[model samples]
Target: MLKGSAILEKATGKDGTQSNHSAGKLLMIIECLADKSEPVRLMDISKELKMNSSTVLRFLTALVDNGYAKQEPETARYSLTYKICTLGSKVSSHIGIKDVARPYMTELSMLFGEVVCLAVEQDREVIYIDIVQSSTKMLRSMQRIGHIAPLHCTAIGKLLLLNYTDEQLDHVIADKGLTKFTESTITTKEQLVEELQSIRWNGYAYDDEKCEIGARCIAFPLYDVEGKVIAGVSVTGPTARMSIKQIQLKLQPALQIIGRLRKELGYTG
Candidate 1:
């Protein structure tokens, strides 16, 4: 039985029996092990956390079972697994990409008086991670954050598609089957491949009412620290307000913003 302590007291319930103290104690154990230079023994964890040895063992067992911690069979010492490092890297990458791109998205929206969207490719589709509506009261778009759209129709989608190899693009089109949303939507693999080449040459892509009738979008790819296309940024609006000529004239500012964003993300090329 553990002696009286604030943690144990807080872990105990009104019924006077030991409650689920495992959660807090588990965290404490992890923190204790993290601060140490080497794998820690069970007794050391229990002593440092001021919890019962049995309770520490129970939590440690759960950690090991869940792949968050590992134990040396001969030494009976425990340490955190590489899974934590993997999770941390993923979280950092996601946050870093989004953080570097958000200001650029907002700047584009304000500069163009059109909706701006940030999206990343996942499983051959473009998933919207963020959206900033135009400042203009009557001209705002209704696209929601976290919405998903096909990668063959939208400007952002095509911008990302430019990164794909010929074989990879063929595979995606074969699997996803470039279903048309409008008359302008690329309905064949050949047409999409040709458009992708043009996008690479022009350094940007235009939706031009391809995804939805009367909607126009101009998008450019964003590179990561590794010079790989990690996401796309787009300025989107109704065609009546954002015609092809207007979008062409406004391309310089968008390019400058994307250049700044790429540099912030550590893209050298």
Candidate 2:
């Protein structure tokens, strides 16, 4: 509910102290940019923050240099960068999912003898929050914490996207452009929708070397207390070791684990 200048003012700190002036100003500029739905001009930021144009330009330059903000040359307007969202997501996933899912991920790795991953959706991309290496290490995957995979191809990504409404799904797919990572990747909206229907009916999803050439992944959705899909739990390995039959067999145990995990997260449904 906060507006541009108010956001800037509050970023100055709770005590309204000038001790951390530079840091506060930087945060203020970020908040001001974040408050806007689109890029804002230098004069707008300066006027909103009650700061001089020169000071605003200096802060903007610093922010742009640090990859936190970008400027449009023709428009001369500044906007927050994807870097802010990426950093925020990393911090959030580290603080939230990793600690809670670590034991479960470890158990999955031991049981399946394959890599276990915990991930959540962000901007239609799946970001792995935690990973447990395979015990055998013979069929390990390339996924790691903070790795981003397309929502239409990866198992966890599809699991997360399955919960989206049709309109939302279409928007995400349009924005992300379904870049094919492998021959098996779903490149058409119709194909993806059909796959999503199957995922819903099966209560799980499979990558089937769709994200990478020789990797296979099976993922189950994790729900929050509200029965909202909050994240996904997946197992990954080489396709040779995780063939279609093998993935189908692993789906049951994965479902059981996800059911317990959902309950642990207070999911009533």
Candidate 3:
């Protein structure tokens, strides 16, 4: 377990001659603020980082000035802002899940001659981060990387919601009302609750021309090392080629590939 001071020293340089000492100290203060769930006092941060109160205040002032942190007017305590999470999300979108899942997406696309997508939940919607287009020349899915879809309509979106509690689900419905896109689209809480139950029992989700009239999809949950649903992978195609029967026939092979992917991701269940 490397301590924060050790990391700070390494980041600044072991030799005490580094010019980036201020940058390192700023980062240390940021980490100190992040480690706490509630707003932290100025003196507590100074004591924990072994720095003078004035020095910590200077760095904290800079952070607050830049919108990376906020100070409570009543409590006079500091805490990190959503800006930190914004920076982290930008970095993770570029190098994390998309990179690890692209090869598997390609495999699925090649195996099925259909579009494959990788998606994660953000702000109550599913965002497609990576896509492997099918080799088929006739028709291509309109979905593109970075496109967002509602959580109640698409197969991948429903799959990603497997872990949401009833209260959370209700909140989502209240925030983003289920807008119907097609005749089969679920438009009420009761319908969505029943659909989610079936998804849980079947270990997968299906979109039967729900999102778009001719488009259909089948999706499975992608798990992290802790057995949490981190994302979802789905195959989409035209209704002519991806009827319910066809989706059922392809289910086992898709599950096999996903099983291998889960193992690689260190998911035990």
* lDDT of all predictions: 0.79, 0.79, 0.82
Clash totals for all models, in order? 0, 0, 0
Candidate 3: 10-residue stretch with minimal lDDT: 1-10
Best by TM-score: 3
Q: Rank the candidate models, highest TM-score first.
A: 3, 2, 1
Candidate 3 stretches with Cα past 4 Å from truth are: 1-94
Candidate 2 lDDT tens digits, 50-168: 98888788778766766778999999899999988978865764467667778888878877788888988776788888788876776545688888888889888888886789999
Please estimate how well model 3 matches the true structure, expressed as its whole-model Cα lDDT.
0.82
Residues forming the 10-long window of minimal summed lDDT in candidate 2: 7-16
Alpha-carbon error at 116 in model 1, in Å? 0.5
Could you tell which candidate, 1 or 3, scores higher by TM-score?
3
TM-score of every prediction relative to native:
0.67, 0.68, 0.72
CA lDDT, candidate 1, residue 167: 91
